[model samples]
Target: MTGYGLHTPIEYLKGVGPQKADVLKKELHIFTFNDLVTHYPFRYIDRTRYYKINQLQADLPAVQVLGRLISLGQIGQKRSKRLVAQFVDDTGIMELVWFQGIRWMEKSLKVGSVYLIFGKPTLYNGQFSMTHPEMELYNPAKKNIGNLSLQPVYSSTEKLKQFFLDTKGIQRLQETLIPWIAKEIEETLPTYILKSQHLIPKGLAILHIHFPSNMAELQAAERRLKFEELFFIQLKLLKNKLLQTNKFKGHLFDQVGTTFNTFYTKHLPFPLTQAQKRVLKEIRQDTHTGAQMNRLLQGDVGSGKTVVALMTMLLAIDNGCQACMMAPTEILAQQHYHSLLHLIGDLPVSIKLLSGSTPKKERKELHEALMNGSLDILVGTHALIEDTVQFLNLGLVVIDEQHRFGVEQRAKLWRKNSIPPHMLVMTATPIPRTLAMTLYGDLDISVIDELPAGRKPIKTLHLFESSRLRMFGFMREEIAKGRQVYVVYPLIKESEKLDLMHLEAGIENLTREFPLPQYRISIVHGKMAAKDKEFEMQRFVKGETQIMVATTVIEVGVNVPNATVMIIENAERFGLSQLHQLRGRVGRGGEQSYCILMSSHKLSNDGKLRLQTMVKTNDGFEIAETDLQLRGPGDIAGTQQSGILDLKLADLSTDQLLLQEARNLVLGIFKDDSTLDQPKNELLRKHLSRQNTGISWDKIS
Candidate 1:
C-alpha cells in the first residue's frame, strides 16, 4: 500500500494466484497491484554479457550463454516433435532446441547443471541452434548483485504462454512485483517537471524501468517513460482543445453575399490558387471567429479541393446559413453532385443530391428541400448522416475523405444545427507533419500548398517490363491526342501472392492492344456494381473511354478531365501515399499529363523510392513525408480510430524532437496553470486525474 497508489488485488501479487489472476485478467490487461506495476517492459535484455559457443554469429545480437545441459535428446515424431539439447559453453558446443515445451523441456532439465541461456543464435545445419532459449539456474553471486544486469521483456500471450506467462513468466511476475512496489513509486512529474525535464524520479523511474542497473540507467529510464507518455498525450489533446474552444458558441458567417460574389466573379472554373487565396483567407477567418470552425483542408490530389469546397459553400450561402458535403462514396457523392452542378453554373444557389441512390421521388424532394431552408448546398453520401437528415440552417459542414469518415461518422455531422456546424475537414491524403501533429491536433490546419496557375507539371516516367511496346506507343499517342488512358492494377485477380497487373488480365491485355472498334476500354474496380461503378465511371468521364482499366478504385473517386495517361501496373505494389494517389489520377488535364511507372525489373528499395519520388517532384507534402518515412505511423494510423498514437514509449515516427519536447511542456503547463489550479501543478493535477481518458481520441469514434 504505497505510491503505485495500491489498489492491490492482482490476486495478491507474488507470482499471482487465483488462476494466475484469471490469466492476469484474461491475457495481460493485468488487473491491479496497479496493473502489475504498470505492465511496462516491451524490451531490455542485456543480461550483462555472456555469449560463448565460440561467440555464435548469424547476425548475432541477443545473447547471453554460460551454458551446459550437455545431454537431453528425443526428436522428430508426431507432428514432427523435437527436443534436442547438447548446450556446452566455455567456448564451443550448441543445439538447445524445443519446438515448444518438449515434455515440459524434458521435465525441466538439470543434466550437468550450469545455466543462464537467454536467446538469439541461428546458423542451422552447419550447426548452432537455440530455438526458444531463456533458462535460469546459474548464480555467480546472484549475478553480481544486480541480478543478471538488466532483463525485463514482457509482452506475452499464446494464451499467456499457456499460463506460465512467458517473457520469462512475465519476468517472474516482475521479479516479485519490483521489490514490492519499487520503494513505493510516486512522483508523477512536476518538481519543475523534475528539474526541468532532466527527469528520473518516479521511484528511480520505476526502478530503472524494471531492473536496469546500467546502460546509463536504461537511457535515463527511457527518457522518463517517454516523457510520461508524450506528456499525458499532449495534455489530453490540449485539454480537449481548450474545452472545445471554451464550450461551443459559433455560427458567425458575416455575409459575403451575392452568393459569394456571384461565384467568385462569373462561375470561376479556374483561378483561385494563391493557395486558393490563402485557403479562402483561412476560411474567412474561421467564419469570422465565433469559434466552431474545426478546419483541416489539406489539399493535393488535383488541388482545388473541389474548388475550395465550392468557395466554402459560397460562405454558407452568404450567411443565411445552409451548406453540407459528406462523401466517403456514393461514387463520391455522385462525384460531388456532378462537380457542384458543374461549378455553380446558373447560380441562384440551391444545390442538392443526397445518396444511397436517391430517388424515392428524389429523396422526397430532397427532404423537403433540406428541411425548408430551401437547400443551398447539399452534396452527399453516408447519406448525410440520416437522423432523417434534417438541416434547414446547416451552416457549413464539408467533410470529403476526412480519413474516410469515422468518429461516429463525424459525430452525426455534429448533431446537425442548433449551433455546432462550421467544419471543413477535406483530405486528399497528404497528412504527415508528424501525422498532422498527432492526428489533426484538434483541427485548424489549412494547406492547399499551391497548384493552380496554368497547371502542367505532371510528366513522371519510370517504365520497365521492357516498356510494354513503348507503353503501347504512348497509349496510341494519348489516344490520338483526344487524350485519356488510366490502366492502374495491383491485382483484381491472378494473385498467387502477387505478380500483379490483373484487372481482368489487364482488360484481356488491353483487348489485344487497343482493340474493339479502334480502342474503347473503361472498366473501374472496387468490384463494380455501384451502378456498375457509375457506368464505368461515366465512360471514362464522357471522353467515351479511350481506356480506363482500373482498381485502386480509381483512388479517390474519379474526376476525369479528359483523362491523360496514368499507367502504374505493379509499380512496386504502391504506397508512397499510394504512388502519390496514383499520380493524382493524371494531372487532371490541362494537357501534358503523363504518369507511367510500369515496373518489374525487380525494383524494391521501397520500389526504388517510389519511382524516385514519382520522378522527383509533385510534392503532396513531399509525398506525405516520404509516406511517413516509408510505411509507418501504422499506415497513417489505419483510418485513425484514434488511439492517440497508441504509443508505448513515444514514436510518432521517431519522436519529432520528443514530440516538440512533449508539446513544449504542455505549453508551459497550460501557461502557468490555466485551471490545472496550481499547487506546483499538484502532481500534474493528480497524474491527470488518474490517467483520465474520458473520451477524446481527438473527439471520439
Candidate 2:
C-alpha cells in the first residue's frame, strides 16, 4: 500500500483469522492491518539497566537480577498451587514466585540455569522476591546479556492475548510494517523544512516509536508525531475559518453614535469603565464592517459586559434593525430583560422576553410584534429559535455564556434571518490569553478587565471538615445580622452507585442542625422539576427563605444579592473555574460576603493548588490562569462543547510557543500561495493530508 493508502485486512495478515480479527476490532478498535500497526504503546518499560537484589526498595518500582535457579518446587494442591524458584545474582539472592501459571515457566526453567528476570522487586522479612517476573531461557551465545533495553507495552485484551496476539505479537506486526512504510511512502516535507525543524522522517519516526534504541530517539519520535498531529488539526480549523470569512456577509449597520451618546450623556447610571469603553469601540468597528462579525466578548464576573451589550443592541436598533439576546437559561434571560428594561426605560425602543414557559397568548403576541418591527429588543432562551418566530430585520444576535450552547443550536439562530446575523458571544468565565488565542482563533476577542463600581471584593477562606462546628457558629452569626446564606453540596441524594455519599449525608445533617423553624431554609437540586426549582428560587429571592441549600444548578445565573455567606461542602470535588462561578453568586450584594471552601483533611496536589488559588485571589482572571496551568487547555475550556478546536496532541498550555510558531508558518505559507500549489506548499499539503484523513484539503481548496 502507498503511504496515504489503507493497509490490508488484519484477517489476511499472518496468524490472524476472522474470529481473532473480530476480537481485536471490538476490544482495541483495530480493524485493518494499518490500525494494528499504528496503535502506539501508552508507555514503554525500560529494561536496559538492572539493579542487584540488595538495592531493591519496597516502595519504589525497580527491576532486579536473580542468579541461577538451584531448585524449582510447587506448594499447596491443584487449584492453589504456586511455583517457587530461588536464585542469586551479583549482590544477593532472591526468590521468584508464580501462581497458577507454573507449567509454562517449568518448561522454560532448568535447574542450575542462569536467566535474566525483570519485574517489580519487593523485600519481605529481609528476603527479596518477585511475583511472576517476565522470564526468558538463558542463552550463553547472546552478547551483553545484562543490557536488556526498553520494551514496548501495547494494550491488549485477555481474549486476544489468549490467541498469542499480545504486546509481542503487535511488535511483530510493527516490524513488518516498517519496511513497507519506508519503501512505499514518499517524503512529503521539503528537506529544508525538515532539517530546520529537526524532525525525523516518517519511516524512522514510526520505527523508533515502536522500538527505540535509546531515550533520545524515543523523545525525538514523540515530538515529531505530536507536532504533526497538532499542525494538521489546526490547519483544518484555519481553513474552515477562511471559508466562513470569505462567504458570509454581514448586515453592516450604519454607525449612529448619536443615540448611544445620548444615553451616555443624559440617562447613563454611571460612567462607563475604560475597559467597557474599549470593548464597545471594538464591537462598533466590527459591526460597521461588511464581513460577518464573529467576535467573543470575555470578561470576569461583574465586568459590566451587560451594559456594553445593551449599548451595542441600541446601535442596531438606531439603524432600524432588530436585535436579540439568547441566554442559556430562562432565569438569566429574565434577568437580562429586567436589567435592560431599567437601562433603556427612557428610550423609545420596546424590549420583550420570550422563554420556554412563556404563555401561548404572550408568545403569539411576541412573534407578531417581532415580525411587524414593534419589538426593538427580544431576549429569551432557545425558545427564540422556534419556527413561528420571525424577525423584521435581525441585525445582531448576542449569545450570553457561549459555552452552554451547542454549535448546531447557534447555527439555528443564525438561520433565523436571511443574511446571517452578526454574532457577539459573551462569556463570563475569563480564559487565559494563550488558550483564548488557540480556542477562539476564528473569532476576534475583546476582554473587559475592569469591574463596575460598588463591587466589593469577596473574602475567601479554606477550612477543614473538622472546623464544621465553628463554621456553623459563624454562619448563624451572619444570619442573625440579617444576611442570607447559601450551603452548596456536590450531590443531591445518597446514591448506592457513587463513592461520595458524604455530600448527601451532610445535607441531611444540616437539615437537622438548622431546622426550618429556626431558619427558613429552601432546597434546590438537579433532579427537581423546573416548576419546583422556580418556586424555591422565588422563595429565596423574595426573602421568604433566609438560607438556601442547593447543588451546582445555582452555579450559572441565580442572582440573589442578599446572600452574603457561601459555603461549599467538599470543594475539592469541583474544578477551579466551577468554584469561582459558585463564589460569584454570593458577592453580588452591597453587604460583605464570604466564601468558605470546606475540604477533607487529606487533599491531592491539584486539589490543594485549586483551593490555594481561590484563597489567594478574588480576581477571576488570575484564577482562570491558574486553572489553565493546573488542568491544561482541554479541561479548562471544554473543547467538545465550547466550539473550541479539539487538538489531538498539542497541549495549549505547555506548547504555547510551538503553537505560535506553527500558526505563523501555516499563515505565511497560505499567504504566499492561497491554494498551496507551489512545490514547497504542495509537499506541506501532502504531509497534512497523510496525517489527517478526515480533513478534505481538496474541498477546502
Candidate 3:
C-alpha cells in the first residue's frame, strides 16, 4: 500500500474487533493502522529453550520444566478449590499447583499424560513447584514441540487479557499482517544506502521485530528501527532551527562587553570565574548575530549561572530593550530578585518583583511601570505571563530552570512583543552533552564548568542510622562555630499505620533531644501554607533559626550562605539527582559545608551506589551522569511533564554513539537537499511522514 493510501482505522484490522480496538485506542493510544504498526515492543523475551526443573534456583527469573503428571487432585472447599498435581521427570519430581481455576485444570490434566510446563520455579514445603504454569499437552499425532522460540510480549490492558487477547493473541495479528506488509510496502531507501548503513529493509525489519529467527536478525532489525525514529526527529528539529535562523532577524546587542566591563571595574563586587566568562562570551556572540538567540546555560550548584543571566540581561538594557526573568516558584522568584538587587544595586537599572502574592494595587503599579519601560528588569513566576502584563520593548526573556515550563508557556513569553524575544534558558541540573544536543539541538549550549573563589567544596560522608549521636555532635560543633544546620526528613506527617520515619516525628524528637531553649529550630513541609513556609524559610535564610527540619520541598533555590551543615535522613529512599539537589542547599557560603547521608542498614545495590557517588564527587555533571547510569533516563530528565522529549528506542545514556551518528546524518542530508525533494531523497521523505506524524512539516514544504 502507498503511504498515503494505507489509512485504515484500527477497528477494521483482522482479529481486532470493535471491542478490542476500543481498548487499544484507550489504553495504548493506538487509533489507526499506522499507530498499530509503530507500537513497538519495549523488550523481547528469548523463550527458545528451557532448563531442567532440577537446575532451578531461588530468587532467579528463569524458565524451567517438569516431566509428566503422576497424580492430580483437588483440595479445599467448593468456593476455594485448589488443584494439586505431581510431575516426575527422569531428573527430579515436583508439584504443579493452581488456585484460581481448579475445574478447568481437572478437565485438562490426565494422570498418565506427559506435558511441557513453562514457568518460574519455586520452593514450596521443601519441594520444588510451579504455580499457574503455562502448559501444553504432548500430542504425538500433531508432532508439536511447544513453541521453543523467541516471543514478542506486547503491552496489553488487563481488560484485553481477560478477553483472551494476550501476548499470543497479538502475535497472531502480527502473523496475519506479515504477508500483506511484504507484498504492499516497497523498500523506500536505495539498496546501496541500506547496504552501506547496515540497515535492513522496512518489510524485513517489521517482520523480524515481531518474530526473529536468531539474535543477529533481531539486532539488525532493532538498529534500523531505532535509527529511523531518531533520524527523522533530529532532521525536523534542525530544519526548524535552520529556517528560523535564516528568516527571522534579531536586534543585535553588541554593547554587552562595554556595559559588563564598566560594571565589573566600578560597581561589581567580585570577579567572574573562568567558566562563567566563557559562557558569557558565548551568549554575547549569540546575541550579536542577526539570528535570534536560543541558548541553554548549564552549571553545577554554585557555578554561578545566575550571574551570567544577569550580565546577559544587562546587554538587553544597554541596547535600549527591556528584559524579564521568570522563575518557577514564588520563593525562588523572590530569591532571584534579592540576588539581582544586591548585584546591580549601584547601577542605574530599576528591578521589580511580581508574584501572585503581590497586593492588587501594587500589581497594577508594577504592570504600569513594566509597560512604560520604567522597570529595566522584572523578576516573577508565571504571574509575568498574565495577559494584563505587557512589556514596552521586550528583547530578552530569561527562563530559570527551563525544564519547569512547558513549550506553550515558553512561547507565550515571546508574544509580549511584536518581534519574538531572544531566549536564554538557565538550569542548575547539568545535562549530559549528547542528550543536550539531541533534545536542545535548536539552542546553543554553554556549560559553566567551575565554581567561584572563596566557595568551599562540600564535605560529603555516608553513615548508618546508628551513628546519629556522632552526627549530632558534629552538628553541635558547627553550630558552635556560628554556622547553621539543616535536618531533612523524607515525609511530612507521622502516620501511625506506616513504619517509616517522618519529618513531624523527627522534628519532635529533635526538639526533645536538643531543647528549643538551647537552639531555635523551624519546620517546613509541603502541606503547610505557602506564606507559613516562606516565613520559615526566611527565618533560616536570615540565621534567625539555627536548624531547619524539612522535607524535599527545599531541595531547589533555597540558598543559605551561613548554613554549613546538611543532614539527610533515609537518604536511600531518594534518587541521586534529588540527593545532589539537597546537598546543594548547603555549601553556598565561604565557610566549609558538610553533607551527611544517613540510611538504613538494608540498602540495595542502587541505593549504595547513589550514596557512594555522593561521597565520591561534588561535580553536578558527574553526579548527573552516574544518576543516569543507575536510574536510566526516566527520572534524570523527569518524564514528559518536565518538557522532556520521550524517545521510543534511543536511550539517552547508552545510545550516545547512535545519537551522534543520526545527528550527523541529518545535518549532511539537509545540507545537500534543503527541501528533501531530490529523487534520491524522496524515499526519506515518505519514511519520515509515515513514521513520525507529530512534527510540524509546513515550513519544510
Evaluate model 3: give its lDDT.
0.79
| Per-residue lDDT of candidate 1, residues 124-201 (tens digit) | 878888887878888776743237487778788788888878787777777777676867766777788878888878
lDDT value, residue 345 of candidate 3: 70
lDDT of 3 by residue, 85-184 (tens): 9888887888888997678879977898888777778887788888988777755465212242566678877887876667666666666665466455
Could you tell me every candidate's TM-score relative to the true structure? 0.40, 0.89, 0.90
Better of 2 and 3 by lDDT: 3
TM-score of 3: 0.90
Worst 10 residues of 2 by lDDT: 692-701
Candidate 2 clashing pairs, residues 3+ apart or interchain: 48-149, 67-88
Candidate 2, 1-701: lDDT as tens digits: 34333366777665677987888888888887567656887778777666777778888674746467778888888878999988787777888899956897888788888787878777788897899887765664764312336677788778878777777777666666555654544555567657877898866777777778789988887777666655665565566556556777888877676777788787777788899989988988887877777788998876778889989998888877899999988878987888898888788779999998899999889999998999989999999877888999999899998777666677777888888788888988888877776667657889998777777889999999799899999999998998889889888777677545354676677777778787888888888887898899889988888888889888876778789999998899899999998998888867889999999888999999999999999888889888988887767655555534545445666776777766676677667866667876777677656655352222211
The local lDDT score (0 to 100) that residue 70 gets in candidate 3 is: 90
Q: Number of clashing residue pairs in every model?
A: 0, 2, 0
Candidates in order have lDDT scores of: 0.79, 0.78, 0.79
